[model samples]
Target: MTHTTRTNRGLLRGALTLAGLGLTLTGCTGTGDPAHPITLVVRDAALREIGADCAGATPYNYVHAGTELRFLTAEGTLADSHTLSPGVAVAADDRDYGEATRVPSLCRFTVDGSALTAGTTYTLSFGDRKSQDFTYQPGETAEADPVIALPPLGDPTTEDTD
Candidate 1:
């Protein structure tokens, strides 16, 4: 065989090896889709909105305790449900109303995105309040944290049934 023929064969073999390596790496990486975890911030806005005359600061204490977070699919099916009772510890953000008034606390809950389907709509209902509907879009971009207002659950009349 000629030297040129041998050289050509070696070059072809190296090309094939590199191509195979690339395909193997691509398979290992799997799909580009990424899991998106939704973080919900529940704020007790009753004191802040309707003044401190509602119930006082103690009403805001453990605001998210025993709250139900339901993730409803677009077809109105229950995808998953999580109770915030023994979940993540409640966090408080107090705003000073006045020296004579007591401060209120806020809460936050994190939703697992494992069961969340991409490009699907979900209504996240908390307690007896009106639910907030949102679409799950998983991609390279990140979205701001969603805030769900946790009004004083003391009074059912105060709840937003709408």
Candidate 2:
């Protein structure tokens, strides 16, 4: 890579790292109170909303099926988990209010603990067949967007880490 390109890439990585550290200093996501309830919705490539995981002759229509979500504390403690599908309850768990969260889309995550942003709906997805998770913020909802675009898992240039 050229000197300028390499320098920019390094700077970008450094900025991302600092952003992550800042998020770590923040508290929980302020979502998922056990007393309250949450729900999930599934959509397809066509953005058709469905009541459950897609099945039968054309199962490709449902990508959210079989995806899992784990609500946790700021310290990575498990508050609750959800095997995502259409019309599934968010399974409110009083155990811990979510802080930071990991995503099923391997490398993707929300360091700011904004995955379950309240009163907002988001589409959670990565590559085809690689499911991701999101939440319908309490008191607000939206029609599911098409599968979202995210960075690839692991490093594309490297082989096995071992």
Model 1: ten consecutive residues of lowest lDDT? 47-56
57-116, model 2: which lDDT tens digit per residue? 124334244445455444444444555432211111112334523211111122122335
Cα lDDT tens digits for candidate 1, 1-162 = 212344444543343333223323332111122244454433432333221112213444433546667878767778877665322212133234566343432233345566777677787665555366766664353333222333311223343334
Q: Which candidate is the best by TM-score?
A: 1
The estimated TM-scores of all candidates read: 0.42, 0.25
> lDDT per model, in order?
0.42, 0.30
Candidate 1 lDDT (Cα, 0 to 1): 0.42
Worst 10 residues of 2 by lDDT: 102-111
> How far off is residue 76 in model 1, in Å?
1.4
Q: Give the CA lDDT, 0 to 100, for residue 100 in model 1.
A: 32
Q: Which segments of model 2 are wrong by more than 4 Å?
A: 1-35, 41-63, 86-162
Segments in model 1 whose C-alpha atoms lie over 4 Å from true places: 1-36, 45-63, 85-105, 127-130, 138-162
